[model samples]
Target: MKNIAILTLGLRHNYGGILQAAALYNFLKREGYNPVLLRKYPVQKGWKAIIIKALEILPFQNLKGFRNSYIKYINNIQFFDEYMPNQTKIMTYKSQIEEFLNKYEIDAIVVGSDQVWRYTYINDTEYDTYFLNFKLNREIKKISYAASFGIDTWEAPSENLNIKKYLSDFNAVSVRESSGQEICKKDFGKYDVELVLDPTLLIDQSFYLDMIKNKSPKNYDCITYILDENTEKKELVKKINVECQHKSVFNLLTKSSKLSVQDWVASFKSTDFIITDSFHGMVFSIIFNKDFLVIINKDRGADRFYSLCKILGLESRLVTPDSVAIDRMAPIDYSKVNEILDQLRVKSKQFLINSILE
Candidate 1:
């Protein structure tokens, strides 16, 4: 079996990041390839990091800061220790990453299934790394599977130049959205870029269902997985809860209480309906055949929602809080949705197979 190293966002407090990384790993493994997540620690050496470190050591760290950090640490522990036990140890520097790749005898490096190419998450100097900049043997394949830009537009002229140069090295390039395909063509002049499904969507619903099969179900009429705590969105959920007075509403976005990945899946599975501003939240809802509404999150890139809904022919599902009455909308007829997904799944699977094998 060929060994593949996947470079993605670090295992952080975010549920989507952790789950997508695991999805790619699991998908490759099921295809008879050995896939391991390359754990890259964030570079924390700016004034912000300095100030945080000083606060911690001076015994005067504010209670709010301490509490937030503790919660993040606990989330990381649960994700790394329990969910992703086979992930590589922390690789802090570029040299460490190169050494680990060589030591593992990795045949290919896949940067993907998340915002690995998102400029905001990375420093300017490290742009090439996401493009697989490091030296490797000529026979080693360099590929990107469902890599996302997280936004519709490209960076500055100089940045685009650098991106174009680095991206030219890839053996295969696949993006997560249609907007990403346009960007690749316009910015990098890479017209052959394949628009692939997100790693989570690449895997079947059965993969997630198996994990929560042994767990007990929770009682909830609605699950609101709002990532952006917008006042209007929260109020909408509240209004819906009051209207459905007979059933209980569960808010899965509690700040202090972070649920395990399995618990997150179970929450969605057990709920009668879902209302969310998260991309992944909307995705799982559709996959599970649950009726849901997507509140466009402009700040966090609404292109993802637009692209996905357009492809799946669920554009009506994406709406503002005030535009539609949650209760009045008819139940989603998933026949069309499922048919579209079936075709997409076949194309996406073939893309992955061709990217890796040929």
Candidate 2:
């Protein structure tokens, strides 16, 4: 079997990040490739590393800085322990990445399925490692599958040339959003980019169905999976629950619920309705054929939601906080959505196969 190394945002405490990484890994495994997640640790050294270690050791429960850092660490540990055990190996430096590439004899490196390409996400660094900045042999394939820019547009005047140069080296490139395709063409002058489904969507619903099979159901009428905790969004969910009698709303991520990734999938599968601003939340709701209302999250890449909804013919389901009159809205016609997904699934699978096999 050919060895494949997936470079993604696996260390994030977010459900979408973890699940998408799993989805791509699982998909590659099913395709008969030996896939491993490249766990790239931050290149903290000397005083910086020592400071972090000190903070970790210090029991400053009263200090918000120490408390928040501790919580983040705990959450990351929990995610890796429960969901991604034995799937990852560490690469702490650029030399380590190069060493790993040679050590594993990896056939290809797939960068992907998230906002890994976004400058802000990479601490505003130019020529992020996600763009495959490392030196490598010319023959080894570099593919970008469902990689997203996370915004409709970007203004990286200084990095434009570098972006184009790095992206030019890819054997194949596919983006998660239509806007991404546009950006590649307009910004980088790369017209050959293919717009493909997120890795989360590329997998069959049955894949997720199996993961959630034996889990107990959540006792709620609606599940709200909003990433942003704005009062307007919160109040809209509350209004919907109150107006739609017998429908109790449960907020998921905002409350920092201790539900594992699998547990979250099960809860989403079992919920009667979904109220979400999260892209993956909207995705799962559609995949499971549940009734859902998408709140527009302008700050968090709302373009992705719009593009996907438009493709699936469910743009009507996307609404602003001001448009939360649930009684007036019609149920989603998922028959049409399923048909679109069926067609896109074939196309996305072909893209993956061609990117890997060709």
Candidate 3:
């Protein structure tokens, strides 16, 4: 068995980060590799640093602060592993990283499942720069597996120079979206880039179902929305839910609503339709074969949904705030969606598995 240090996003409460890490971890274990998960830290001390310690409890603004701090700290970031709430419980973290590097006497380290490298998520930490220059040390092989810059745009020239310095460390790299690939090419001037699916998509529906032990949702027709972006506004969601045909509508913004990602996914599978502004909101709907309308989110890069939709050939279903008629999204071609997923599944497996084997 090879000792693999797999770094992934650790914020488990976040759907995309958690599920992507789960997919990669499960796959790596199946491949007979002992993978050690790492959580990236931006600030090392102070009560203010406590923000990341209780990220879920902190307000959205503070979460943004941690994200920004992380970007500044780690440059060649990959995957971040989510630790349990208590820090002492994960005392072996550094030791595990060192052990994995020395023990199975393995081949390489893998980073990513999502936007682990995007500077917006990194804060003020020198680790951000040195981690990318890790290659120059030449002690171990480094690879980025389906890592995302996460955003659709490029940084200014000065920042690009900082980014370019660290990107030189990767032995191979792949990104989750075309937009991110474009940024890598433009900013880092790296031509060797492959497109890989988000790790959530890397695994099949059965993988998720297996996690829940034969669970199913309440059969009622429901409309589930996780309001991460524009759709969070009360008026917009109320307007859509008021007009939709579904009997029950649920929003994550409510205090009483404590649904986990799988809970949300299960609900998506049973729902007749979905209207969402979140990226994973669209992902689960498509995975479960639910008819859904993606709201254009100007804040979180609206192009994200459209880019995924375009890749799947489902662009006609996109909805805007003024569009006002989600009822029109009915009767999506489930067969067409399956066909696209089938192709993507093959591509995803080839990209991830072959890259590892190579």
Q: Mind giving the per-residue lDDT tens digits that candidate 3 earns over 89-202?
A: 222233444544554455677778666765556443543432334413236667777776656876445667666666676667777778878888887787788877777777
Q: Taking the candidates one at a time, how many backbone clashes does each contain?
A: 0, 0, 24
Write candidate 1's Cα lDDT for 1-358 as tens digits. 9988888877666777878887888888899989878888667778977776666445434454654544555656865655455678887666677777766778888998777777776653466677788764345688999998878986555678778877887889999989899899898888889988898888999888987887776868888888777778877777766755527777887755567777888888888788899999988898889988888887778888999899988888787767557555677889999998888888988988888888
Instruction: Tell me the whole-model lDDT of each prediction, alpha carbons only.
Output: 0.79, 0.79, 0.63
Model 2, global lDDT: 0.79
The 10-residue segment with the lowest total lDDT in model 3 = 83-92
* Model 2 bad stretches (over 4 Å): 43-88, 124-126, 254-256, 324-327
TM-score, one value per model: 0.90, 0.90, 0.79
Candidate 2 all-Cα RMSD: 2.8
Candidate 1 deviation (Cα RMSD):
2.7
Clashing pairs in 1: none
